[model samples]
Target: MAKLQLITPNVAYEQDYKAFYQDWQDSGRAIIPSVAKDLPADFAGYVQRLNDNAQGIGLEEGIVPNSTFWLVNEENNEVLGAVNIRHQLTPYLERVGGHIGFGLRPTARGKGYAKTMLALSLKEAKSLELEKVLITCDVDNVTSEKTILKNGGRRSTDEQTEEGIIVHRFWIDL
Candidate 1:
């Protein structure tokens, strides 16, 4: 691992962003980050959408104000993963999504980056004045569970979604 830092995605990171996006697609992951919902084929539009979401502009229904950050290897400026922190929870989030959601490129997995990135996201959540942050992962996702635990997350409860998926929820006090 190189010196990693979370950064707001921008035009200067276009190539790195594309690589990350392609890796996500290649991984065949079912869930994408909230900030990736409106990604356009063009870099300019993608950048604009990221800015809009950050500012609470042109948000779709049921969306809350949030922040998105890309974890980058500062040594080589490689975009490795992304994390989204919701400013506040809605009914749906309270049940399922929680306050933070994160994913790493397939190539970046199993390198302990998830734990590192998650720990960083918790700091961002604390800065938002949240006394604690809620995080949830699918029950079958062992890596995620371990990451949450390493970040001081305590198992709160498990609930089944309408889609019949069991999710484990955890909370980390600030």
Candidate 2:
């Protein structure tokens, strides 16, 4: 185990960005939605895009303002995973999507990083003044369910979206 910390994406993390992206591609997991879309192959462009996203400078329609963080192992400065925290929820979010979205690299799975990263994200959500945050995971993602529960998440409801995916929703009090 290593001491981990969350840091906002920046130019300094280009190498980490590449490595993380490669791992996701290799694993064939559905890409991490917003963070995956518009990721540039070029380093500079990617940093600029991430910066704009964090500042809400230029976002597509229906996308909410969010803060993205990478969980880094402080000892060797390797990226373990990433998380996105929405500032507030829209109607769509209330129904399905949630306040936090997180994923650890395939190589990092089952090492308890998800729970740790999620706990850290919850603190960040609290710092943003969120009294309680909504978090949801696919019905089959047991690891995510456990992480949410470990972080004080209480299951609130389950939804079957038009797309036919069963999503389990939970709320965590700050």
Candidate 3:
């Protein structure tokens, strides 16, 4: 495999994002882009939303400032995953959003793309002056929890939300 490349949202996909969308769709599974913000009701809906933001085809509001997003690609330039990182933490963010989020496209899971993307994003966060970074994953999301731990994340605490979702919090010291 060629070296993986991670680029910001502004330079995420220079080619066809549709191709990446199609690849994921064809696989019958899709990994949520942590950087994509709110996930739509489902995958199909989310793809529509992704294209809209990707192509500037449409727009969304309240994106955090100084936040950077990226697409992870293969040597062939095929997008294998995506990630998002914020330069600073906010109130609600400190509890939930954390300092970063990430995911691997469905078709690309188990290939360690999310891990690579995350490590790369952490480096970027350090560049942005983050001394320690916080990341959270749903308690049941073993895959994500492992991903967090794989990136030097230590278990922080568990949070129970009003909506009832249990989140496992972790922090990485850069």
Which candidate wins on lDDT?
1
Cα deviation at 100, candidate 1, in Å, is 0.4
lDDT for each residue of candidate 1 in 5-42, tens digit (9 for 90 to 100)? 99887889988888888787777775356576444668
Q: Which stretches of model 3 miss by more than 4 angstroms?
A: 10-15, 23-31, 34-63
Model 2 scores worst on lDDT over the 10 consecutive residues at 30-39
- In order, the Cα lDDT scores of the candidates are 0.85, 0.83, 0.68
Off by over 4 Å in 1: 37-39
Q: Write the per-residue lDDT of candidate 2 for residues 14-104, one digit (tens) a residue.
A: 7876788788888877766457534586877766766687678788898888888889998877887888898899999888889999888
Give every collision pair in model 3: none
Please give the clash total of every predicted structure, in order.
0, 0, 0
TM-score of 2: 0.92
Better of 1 and 3 by lDDT: 1
In candidate 2, stretches whose alpha carbon ends up further than 4 angstroms from where it belongs are none
Question: Of the candidates numbered 1 and 2, which has the greater lDDT value?
Answer: 1
